[model samples]
Target: MIYAFLNQKGGVGKTTLSIHTAAELSGRGRRVLLIDADPQGSSLAWSNYREKANFTVVGMPKATIHKEIDLLAQDYDDVVIDGPPRVTELARSIILSADIVVIPVQPSPMDVWAAAETVDLVREAQVYKPEIKCCLVINRKITNTAIGRDVRDALAELEVPVLKNDIGQRVAFAESAASGSTVLNQKLSKAAREIIKFVNELRRLK
Candidate 1:
C-alpha cells in the first residue's frame, strides 16, 4: 500500500506522521519504504541521523512519480510518501501515485483549510486514479479545544473515515525527527501511542 502524508502548509506534522507511521509499520516486520518526496528531505535526513532503521529511506525527489512509484511498490509492503508541504501539482502527482493519501491537518483553521484544499485536489484526481483513497488525519491536536472537536466533527460530518487516534502537540515528535529517530524509537509518549494506533488501523485496512 502507498500512503502519502500531505498538506499545503508546513509545520503540520506531515513528515513526522509519515516517518513514525513508517517506523511503526517496519517495527511490526513489514517491509516499509519511506519516500522523501519533500524537497526539504526531512525524512531522508532523519533516516541518515538514525543510521540504522527497520526500513529503507529513499529520498527520491519530485520526478516521474508514476513509473518510479510503481516500481517501488513492487518491493515494499508499504510505501509512505513524505510529500512537499504545499498543495501544488507536485503534491497532487504524489497523491495520485499513492494507493492511499493521508492528509495531515493540524488542529487549526488555517491547517484545516489547507487540508480541505488538498482533499479537493485528491478528489479531482479521482477522475484519474479512481481507486485511490484519501483520508484526513488531525495531527498536533490539543485536548481541550472545541475547535479541534469541531474539526473532527466536520470531518465526520463529511463522512470521512478518520483515525481515532490523534497525534498531539509534542516536543518528542520534533526531538526524534531532528535526531533521526522515530517516535517509536524514543521514549513512549502520547504521540507514539497515536502513531501505533494509526499504523494498526492502516494495517487493518490492508
Candidate 2:
C-alpha cells in the first residue's frame, strides 16, 4: 500500500504525520519505505539526522515520481510519501501515485479554506483513478477548542471525509523530530498513543 500525506498549504504537519506513520508501520515489523517527494526534502533531512531507522527513506522530489515509484516500491510492503507544499503539479503526481492520499488539515477557518484546492486536485485524480482513496485528518488540533470540534463540519463542505482520530497540538512531536526520532520511540506516551490510534484508523480505510 502507498500513502501520500499532502496539503497545498504549508505548516499543516504533513511531513511530521508522514514520517511518524512510516515509523509506526516499521515498528509493526512491516517493510516500509518513506519517499521524500517534497522539494523541501524535510523527510530526507529527518532520515539523515537519524543514526538508525528500521525503514528506508529516499528522495524523489519530482513531478514525474508517478512514473518511477513502482520500481522503487517493489521490495517494500508499504510506501509513505511526504508530499510537497504549494506545488500543484507535484501534488497531482503524488496523488496519482498513491493508493491513499491523506490530507492533514489544521483546525482553523483559513486552513479549512486552503484545503479546497487540494480537495479539488484529489477529486480530479479520482476521475482518472477512481480506486484512489482520500481523507482529511485534523492535525495540530487544540483540544477543547470550538474550532477543533467543529472542523469536521467545516471540512464537510469540501466533500472529503475527516478521520475521527485526530492528532493534537503537542510538543512531543517537535521534540522527537528534532532528535530524528518518533514519539513511538518514547514508548506508550500521550503522543505515541495519539499516533497509534490515528494510524490504526488509517489502516481501516481500505
Candidate 3:
C-alpha cells in the first residue's frame, strides 16, 4: 500500500509523521520505502543523517510521480510519500498515486483554512479513484488548549474524515528529527506510543 503525508501549508509535521510511520512499519518487518516528493528533500536529508536506517528513502520530486510510483511499488511492501506543501501539479500527482492520503493540519485557524486547497484536491482525486482513503490528522496540538478542541469542530466542516489521534506539540519529535531517528527508537515515551497508535489506526483504515 502507498500512504502519502500531504498538506497545502508548511510546518504541519508531514515529514516528521512520514519518517516515524516509515520507521515504525520497518520495525514491524515490513519492507518500507519512503519517497520524498517535496522539492525541499527533508526526508532525503534525514535518511542521509541516519547511519542505519531500516527502510529505504529516496527523493522523487517530479510532477509525474503517479506514473513512476507503480513500477517502484512492486519492490516494497509499503511506500510512504512525504508530499510538498503547495497544491501544485506535483502534489496532485502524489495524491493520485497513493492508496491513502494523510493530511496533517495544525490546530489553528490559519492552518485549517490553508488545508482547504488540499482537501479540495483530495476530493477531486476521489472522483477518479473513489477507493482512495483520505484523512485529516491533527498535528502539533497543544495539550489542554481550547484551540485544539475548536479546531476539531472547525475541521468537521470539511468533507473528509478526521483521525482520532492528535499528535501533541512535543520536544521529542524535534529531537528525533535532529538525530535522524524515530520516536520509537527513543526511550519509551508518550510520543512513541502515539506514533505507534497512529500507525495502527492507519492500518485499520485499510
Candidate 4:
C-alpha cells in the first residue's frame, strides 16, 4: 500500500507525520519504504538521524520518481510519500501513485484553503486512477478551541470524512522528528497513542 502525506501550506507537520507513520508501520512488522518527494529533504534528514532505522526514507526528485519506484518495488510492503507544496507537478505524481492520500491541515482558514486545493488536485487525478482513497486529517489541533470545531464542521458539511483521531500539538512530536523517532517511541504521550490509532485506521482502509 502507498500513502502520501500532503498539504499545500508549510508547517502543517506533513513530513513529521510521514516519518512517524513510516516508523509505526515498520515497527508493526511491515517493510515500509518512505519517499521524500519534497525538495526540502526534512524527511530524508530525519531518517538519517538514527544510527540504525527499521524503515527508510529516500529523497527523490520529481522527474525520476517512476524509475526510483521500479528500483524499490520488490523490497518493501508499504510506501509512504511526503510531498512538497501543492503548486507543483511532483505532488500530483505522488497523489497519483498513492493507494491512499492523507491531507493534513491545521484548524485555520489559510490551511483550510490549502487543503481545499489539495482535495481538488486529488479529485482531478481520478482520470488516471479512479479508485484512490483520499481523506482529511485535522492536525495540530487545540482542544476546546472554536477553530478546531470549525474545521471539523466545515469538512463534514463538505462531505469530507475527517479521521476520528486528531493530532494534538506536543513537544514529543517535534523531538521525534529531530531524532528520527516516532511518537510510538515517546512512551507515554497521549499524542503518541493518537498517532498510532490514526495510522492503524489508515492501514485498515487499505
Candidates sorted on TM-score, descending: 2, 3, 4, 1
Indicate which candidate wins on TM-score. Answer: 2
Give TM per candidate.
0.92, 0.98, 0.97, 0.93
Q: Write the per-residue lDDT of candidate 2 for residues 1-206, one digit (tens) a residue.
A: 99999999999999999999999999999999999999899999989888677999999999998999899899999999999899999999999999999999999988998888899999999998999999999999998999888888989888888899999999999998898988888777988999999999999997
lDDT of 1 at 112: 67
Off by over 4 Å in 2: none
**Any residue pairs clashing in model 1, and if so which?**
none
- The lowest-lDDT stretch of 10 consecutive residues in candidate 4 is 63-72
lDDT pick, better of 1 and 4: 4
Q: Global CA lDDT of candidate 2, please?
A: 0.92
Q: Give every collision pair in model 2.
A: none
lDDT of 1 by residue, 41-155 (tens): 8888788799576898887767567567888888988888988876387786787788888888777677766777777878888998789887878887878989888888677
**Residue lDDT tens for model 4, 1-206:** 88888878888888888888888888889999999989888888887787467987788748456445656646889998888875458877787778898999889888887888888888888777898889889898988899999988787754556898888877888876676667787656798788889888898786
How high is the lDDT of residue 139 in model 2? 93
Q: Which stretches of candidate 1 lie over 4 Å from their true place?
A: 157-159, 186-188
Tally clashing residue pairs in candidate 2: 0
Over 4 Å off, model 3: none
